[model samples]
Target chain A: MKQDGLTIPGLLVASLVGLILVAALLDGRGAHATPGEERLFLPDAKYLKPMLIGFHGVAADLLWIRTVQYVGTHVETDRKFPQLAKALNLATSLDPHFLEPYRFGGLYLLYLARQPQAAVSLLEKGAAANPGRWELPHDLGRYYYLEAHDYARSREWWERAATLPGRPDYLPRFVARLYAETDHRETALELWSEIYRTAQNDSVRSLALQEIERLKAGSSEGPLGL
Target chain B: MTVAAIALNTFREAVRDRILYAILIFALVMLAGSTILVTISVGGEVKIIKDLGLACISIFGTLIAIFLGIGLVSKEIERRTLYTIITKPIHRYQFILGKYLGLVLTLLVNVAVMALGLLGLAYLWEGVSSVRLFLAVLFIFLELMLVTALALLFSAFSSPTLSAIFTLSLFVAGHLSGDLRLFAARFGGAVTKLSAETLYFLLPNLSRLNFKDQAVHGFGVDGGSMGLSFLYAIFHIAALVLAAMAIFERRDFK
Candidate 1:
């Protein structure tokens, strides 16, 4: 420790001292300048790159975990997540493998954030990366089926998702039900009721409940005097 | 003959080591404690349980491998037991291979216990069982075998402290190797790039063994990829154990 030309600790300390001296010099130089009122959050891109990568991954993971939790809380309270859409997007953007960000995150964005376009874009990206994954397609189908009420489009998405690897055997049944929703609203209601009961996350359950109520209300209105 | 006998003897010796009990108890406790941990997670408590359970298994499994592995050969030599064993009827490779297999067997039993704890926690939290969770843990257990083999190789030639440190560094680097190469490509200098590239190929590339993420989301893990990874880890372990045997065979007890 005493005789080495530059031990690892000494080298690290010397570098720290040099950095402090330079920072002090920069501060001294900036002292003469007038303080400007105008300011934008334009951080130094060079330094920010590493920082962004570090924070983005951490934030993305944090947000994903929180979003999953929020899904449950939202369902229990029957609340819309109009604010969580961007956070969810930010998470998925940072970590594309985060499949839930596309499925349930899109759900929040569509129903809660009231951003169907963003939801569509999120699902599309998820579907592309995870083509063999069923969750994204199922959620995409949900967006069209319940939120958009475009049965034809919903059926298309569901059918495609149901064909993916590892999809539940019940997926085709759900697809068939989607097509029959117009004639059999009650069946849809019952299915959604089952989904709501079995739902792991609260937000999804709340969404299912909303759909059930809508279906019940619609059925009672007696099928638009066809 | 002496090498095989020593390795089997060491295996029997290590099974009686108290450190194994201490580590296994801690691991099982943590796995059991995951039930409480799950409640703190936001809404996806099952996901939380799985995450914590898998993490506990990996961490404790690595600890057992490292702690026991580092001493497997070094302790025998330190106690002057290797001199007796080495001058007798066994081959050096048999000793190394036997010791490795024995430690691996210990790891299997320990992992099974921890996995049972995980499965129990999952059952309690979600009221459902995941065969996939067990399969994921199985892969992780296999990965730890590679770590144990590497640790033993280092122990054969180095002091226990150095072996432990080297093995731990390898563990961290192995897990982060993919990310390291990506970072190097993006921003590293010439020397950093060369070293990163060299280490990429030289190391075991344990990230391939990671299916925890897939398990967490209930995503479909590629069976082909998993099979390839298992083979890679096995081959790597065999090569390390053989190298350790080569080193042990040449070293003079005097």
Candidate 2:
């Protein structure tokens, strides 16, 4: 009840009033438009590693979460990334054994950032560091098969990945179809059908069915019967 | 006989302190909470859980070591009980060592409890016993022991507040000593480089004891390094405890 500046309740009310006044003033001036994807100023991990006091794993995790958010922001905004590759490199360097940065970060680079070589390089680094992991090599195989269109490289990566435990059964099927089909359209159809057969959920199955139908349509002289 | 008696006494006193239980409970809670944090991670569930658990154990262990350790001597003096203890026929070095051992015993129990919790959680997460996590926890326990000795040495000669500050400063410096050497070599002249190297050699190179990255990453931590780290910790802790004993022996309880 007493209006003393040093008292707890007095200070609370004063702070609340001060905050409201600031907000009212800012509101009168109008809210500023959200800036374009802000700059990502990432220090080199070599220098940053020492400062983290051996907690670089969590630091890398937090940076990865931020990097994911960064990709999302760019995806929804200008669709241009000036710093994603650097962010991935730094995050991976901060904790080389963190597989997500290598696996999903590589995916983001390949598809979202549209830096195919950078994506390949990130996955290569991951595969080299984590030789036992299948995902990196598997993705590299997928990239070679789908994007690079290099059947030989895809088969090579897929072969190595298939040997590692936990690799999906789809790998050898991919390799078999790679060798069996001379026609690109037929290869695409078979790949989609395998994906449909092994699809984990309805959405994936639907996507695969669409791809199968589209490939069928592309190669078909008539729609009802080939 | 004297050291064991005093050590057991000191351990009993430390075990009774509320702060020890508080820190222990908080650490367990943090370990459990790591599961929730990992839900947002697209992958690395086991990793996030392991890393956070290890970090929680290391940090809370350090807090207990510092908070409880700085009071190991000064609190006795403050309560006017030091005069009674020193008046006994026991050598002051034995008392100091007893206190150090007691705190270390406390730390060992705390670290062990936390380590088991982490291993069980990790097992449930991945269904395999992570011996590597235990290795990391062992090194962390060694690090905490060294820190407790540092706190004892500081508390022997300084107030608890100053002891806490000095011990914490040394902990940070120890962790950064390797980086200091690197930075000095990269950016400094001959004198600076020499000074940095000397300090690096002088300070406890805690990174030498670090196998967390290796363990969590599935990197092979050789028995040689583990043995070396064990010896390194013993040497640092012995030196700190001896120095604290010497200082404590010279101090006038009156």
Candidate 3:
């Protein structure tokens, strides 16, 4: 009887210790990796599509927010943005009409990731998906002119944007100036300044500031010298 | 009079169900939570709220419909209460229709509460509400009505658990039926294509009823399509309910 009593308490103590040890091990494993590590493995949009059960828009919103957070977290590190494009792709694919991810994700790809081709592809996809929205084409024009220096393509995109309703008043002026091929540096400076002022976050603002400084230094060197 | 009495009784019984209230509370919380969620977004805050809110109503309303609906006939039969109702002068079809209507009425009330919460939140955030949002809600209600009909149909012949599974699978399949046709056209062999095409035509094309995208983006849904979608939903519900009645009529109490 005494042995049985002792065995029960002993078994209870052993179970408690085992649970504590298991929890500690799990917590330690979780703490070893950054939280962002877990989000690195996002499933393809095709797999998630059926599971969303018509909540694709909400899924897009949440994924876009996750992309934003991922960028903010990794922007100060290697600035690799390894999953940024994929996250944005998934979000946009889930709801093709969602415009913010396309525009902002394009910018992030262009400036942060230094993948202008990827950025152009994303903006082009956005343009194709949302022909009525002028912003995608407008952003494409800015990207080609500012990042790629593809003046001809930039001019074409700006002209397209000019025809779209709700495009900014300045797009026509930009298109006409592009036709003239005059004051590229000044135009870039003005665009970057506008971006700096309207930037939503510190990282985007700092990126715009860097471009503004580069444009200013280039102008100081000489006309078309740098 | 008999159908009305059974419907009213079913409605009274369903309204008192804690599961209905629980699902409603979760939905309302999610709708309210969308406001908090929008604070983190840079732009399209109103769009985010509307999308999330509308999704919450549709998803939770469907859950309520399925959970309550699956139990409607089965619980009656399980408790032997259905024996009394069947032995009455009323037909079995009346009981099934009454139960279906009762659950749909419950869903209507719950969906209305969620929709109001969403509209109130959207107005608070954006200071404007569109008629398209309400149109989206109407389509969502139609979707829920069909889902309730599906649950009623499955519950007429199967256990509650199996009925819930069947209803849930049909709900998923309904949404994906459009994609199934696309897949058939793209990748399916002749036999597979024929089968996929047949299933696609037979299954409800729920994507046709989705107006959340247009509603969120402030696009107008054409009148003809809206009328067609409504008619489609009504026809599907009528077909499913009629099938359920046919099954229930043939069921033997002995």
The superposed Cα distance between candidate 2 and the true structure at residue B86, in angstroms, equals 0.7
Of the candidates shown, which would achieve the greatest lDDT relative to the real structure? 3
* Between candidates 2 and 3, the DockQ winner: 3
Q: Quote the true-contact fraction of every model.
A: 0.06, 0.57, 0.51
Error of 3 at B123 (Å): 2.1
TM-score of each: 0.65, 0.83, 0.89
Question: In terms of docking quality, how is candidate 1 classified?
Answer: incorrect
- lDDT preference between candidates 1 and 2, better one: 2
Please report how far candidate 1 places residue B166 from its true position, in Å. Answer: 1.2
Interface RMSD, in order shown: 6.1, 3.0, 1.4
**Backbone clashes in model 1, listed as residue pairs:** A71-A203, A72-A202, A75-A202, A75-A203, B1-B89, B1-B90, B1-B91, B2-B89, B2-B90, B3-B90
| Candidate 3 structure quality by residue, lDDT tens digits, A207-226 | 78877887777744321232
Residue by residue across B84-123, what tens digits does model 3's lDDT show? 8777898888888888888888888899999999888878
- The segments of candidate 2 whose C-alpha lies over 4 angstroms from its true place after superposition are A1-41, A69-83, A159-226, B183-194
Q: What's the ranking of the predictions by TM-score, best on top?
A: 3, 2, 1
- Candidate 2 lDDT over residue span B198-239, tens digit each: 998879998888888876777777998799889989999899
Q: Count the backbone clashes (under 3 Å) in each candidate.
A: 10, 0, 0
Model 1 C-alpha lDDT per residue in residues B78-170, reported as the tens digit of each score: 899878877776677777888888888788888998888888878876787887787789889988999999899999999999999999888
- Say which prediction, candidate 2 or candidate 3, comes out ahead on TM-score: 3
